[model samples]
Target: MSDKINWEYIKEFNDSIRTIWMPFGLPEIIDPSHSRFSNGVDIQPAWKIPPKIAISTTITGAMFSSRGNPNHPMTLEEISKSAREACEAGSPIVHIHVRDENGYNVLDPEKFHKVIDPLKRDFPDTVFDGCMCALDSAEWPHMESFLKEGLLEVTPINTVAVLYGDTLFAKPPYSMIEKTKICQDCGVKPQIAIYTDADVDNADRFLIKPGLLQKPYHWIILAAVPGCSPMQNPRQMVEGLMRTYNNIMDIDDTASVMVCAAGRASSYLATFAMLMGLHIRVGMEDTVWKWPHKDDKIVNNAEHFKLFKTMAGMLGREVMTPDEYRRMIGLPVRKK
Candidate 1:
């Protein structure tokens, strides 16, 4: 049998267990056991280059209870303070989510400016990445403004339409294509968020093939969230990364892959991703639990980054600097 991965089989496996995401379209249930590539020939870790980790300091989350962490930042000053701490603790890239005075998640560019301006000034080398969340066609201009104003240098493009409770948006094939154009026009790099392997295929066929999305292809793979693609364990994380690597290898082998997850699973999955020479994302946005269990206290963003840094060092994996990370993702150097 050929050692090459069968992309068609992997896509079929993703569809086999696909379930409806309530009010939104179907998102696959990722059980690696079901993937044809799961039990195949072992793929070695990519160690020629060092590892990197991004911090997603999600000030608030879907549950609305500070993700069970009372210390989670809910105001601009608190968020700003957390960002500074995270940067000092060794996080090169920060994925941010801003909140208004009322503690509600808002995509207002002015509010974003309040958070980003001081951050860019304080930590000039830190890479700032964020999401516009669910936006309608009318809100497209606001997104464009965010990019033009230098509020967000890296933006996330969720590969599929998502709906969680009241949060809903359609990221259909056409919308993804349009978003790619927007990223290209604004001179911002798109970090494609993959919930399943099919998302990777769509990105390759619709964006890469058309010359809309460029290299080095950056991706954030979400693992194991209820009502979405599940990849909360080592096996699942390996499966997800393997599928992504196989798909992107066809387009560009130098792509960057970072993994994050919900709740306690976030830490576990991220650790495994590190062992494989893949990057990781940490912070309250992904999980508040300090350990890979629910009994732990809800740690802040800095605490999260410190833990990941310690673990990476223990494993002898050198964490990349902000400039190193910027180079890996093809980001231009910012003036200090």
Candidate 2:
């Protein structure tokens, strides 16, 4: 043993650290043909984001109770109407979570079909996605049935359980695997919902290695879910964004990632992501508030979407049409 520690070993180890931009292979350079870049004013090159941010309209969801807001859409008619408004407002994809007549969350395939079928038929161009949040094995069949019928084009798959205080969401690794397989078999793409950094690590280690998760992986980062890492504060939101960005950057460049928040942070973080040239999701599902600190109440998903549209406009970013979004995310382009 040496009397003094070897400083040369530490130097070599520190110098070996490097960052990889594209891990698997180089992804096609995404061009911002549809985006409106800042032209008149000189802007920093690093400040430029992709011109078009693909937005998802989450029709009816609240961080708290189903009846959290008086204007929460419960009936299929109201849900469909909200979705239509969002589509018209520039949402290429709409994410829905069906509820009962009393505004309670339920996973009934018939209810899902009733709402999704009509909107898909009417919109024709919009893609419909959903939350397959089956907490127990018994609930899996119902969700699986929805996928089998081709009612959903994309569905969310998370490696870990989402928690609210002491309550655990109960998404075992096996369940995630089963869900991923079902999506693959049914031709429904998985959205790989990630709530924390560990989830991303799991994707890199287990999910991708077995080919359980596919390329062009769509990710939804749940930044401010209660009992999850809190992102209600602006500084915390930035930190969360950096952490997510670093983790995903380490995973794959081709992966499509989006940011969303529950309650008050919803619009703020979403707007930030939009300005950063990343995808964003907004609706009553994440929050019932129209602005930060719950300054105003949101009437419906369309209202939430319109506000986001204003933000995108101010930032000089164009919202992608359904077809443009489809092409960007590796989905089939629908005939216009």
Candidate 3:
């Protein structure tokens, strides 16, 4: 009830804020032994292998509405055709999302087989990975059936909850452990989909330390998704990616990190990741737009793959073949 303002308290608060804003000088040369900063130009690790970029294509994602491309693949036959084209275009890894007759994403093993069986027959060298509804109760059963049938070489286990539009994709710690155990038992690999920095810490603590996840870990750093921690801003997207990448490398330096985005920034981020010696995931599943600023819609999965390949060529990086990718990721070659 005093008329006078709290000048002393305000001064104290301003001083604390100034202290928080004080910048510290950084050394001219960062230590090469630093966990996150170990990968530098001069002190490149002798064990580092030659650069061979691996491309993973997501033919169809659950969120795409097929807006401009009415001919977008929805049925099993159409999906198979799209995936085949992608493999033919030099993308060895295909990330799949199977849909029902009504075009709804479902965890049905039979539907997945209908799409995967034909591709497996035709492209034995191609590696297949897929997305699943983490909240579905039948996730495990469907995954088990898929593994038994050899329908997938990799399966995704989201490390944290995220909002995809209005829907919340939740990943309980117990569910993640169970999924990892199933993958380990089946000799299949788990692609950790990281939506935030916390996802990395949780993966290291709940999955890695517990021995549920094994070495040569494969991670997909998801960026620019609608309601995730990373936003659509370019600065935010890159910062989030670098932070997550460093954190993952801290836990497992040999791990394979792949970059993927859910918006127009997909192409830019994928290129940045490729140049940084990381893998990339592209196609309609990640974005409908061909570029960040343009409204151009991606014609097909093959088109996107070809564009990426051209960019890789310009960067002087060779896109790995299916067999080469398999060897790099520690998967046995399907073709003799």
The most accurate candidate by lDDT is: 3
* Candidate 2: pairs in clash: 61-284, 61-285
Tell me the tens digit of each residue's lDDT in model 3 across 72-131. Answer: 677777888898898787688898887778886777777887888888888878888887
Cα lDDT of model 2 by residue, 243-333, tens digit? 8877887778767888774556778888778766788888877776766765677776776777787788888887888778767666778
Among these predicted structures, which one has the highest TM-score? 3
Backbone clashes for every candidate come to: 1, 2, 0
- Among residues 3 or more apart in sequence or in different chains, the pairs in candidate 1 whose N, CA or C atoms overlap within 3 Å are 224-231
Question: What local lDDT score does residue 243 receive in model 3, on the 0 to 100 scale?
Answer: 88
Candidate 3 global CA lDDT score: 0.78
lDDT of 1 by residue, 179-253 (tens): 777786777889988766677777877888888888888988765654445555667656766776677667677
Query: Candidate 2: how many backbone clashes?
Result: 2
lDDT of 1 at 103: 79
Cα RMSDs of all predictions?
15.8, 12.7, 10.4
Give the runs in model 3 whose Cα sits over 4 Å from its true position.
1-50, 68-71
TM-score of candidate 1 to 2 decimals: 0.77
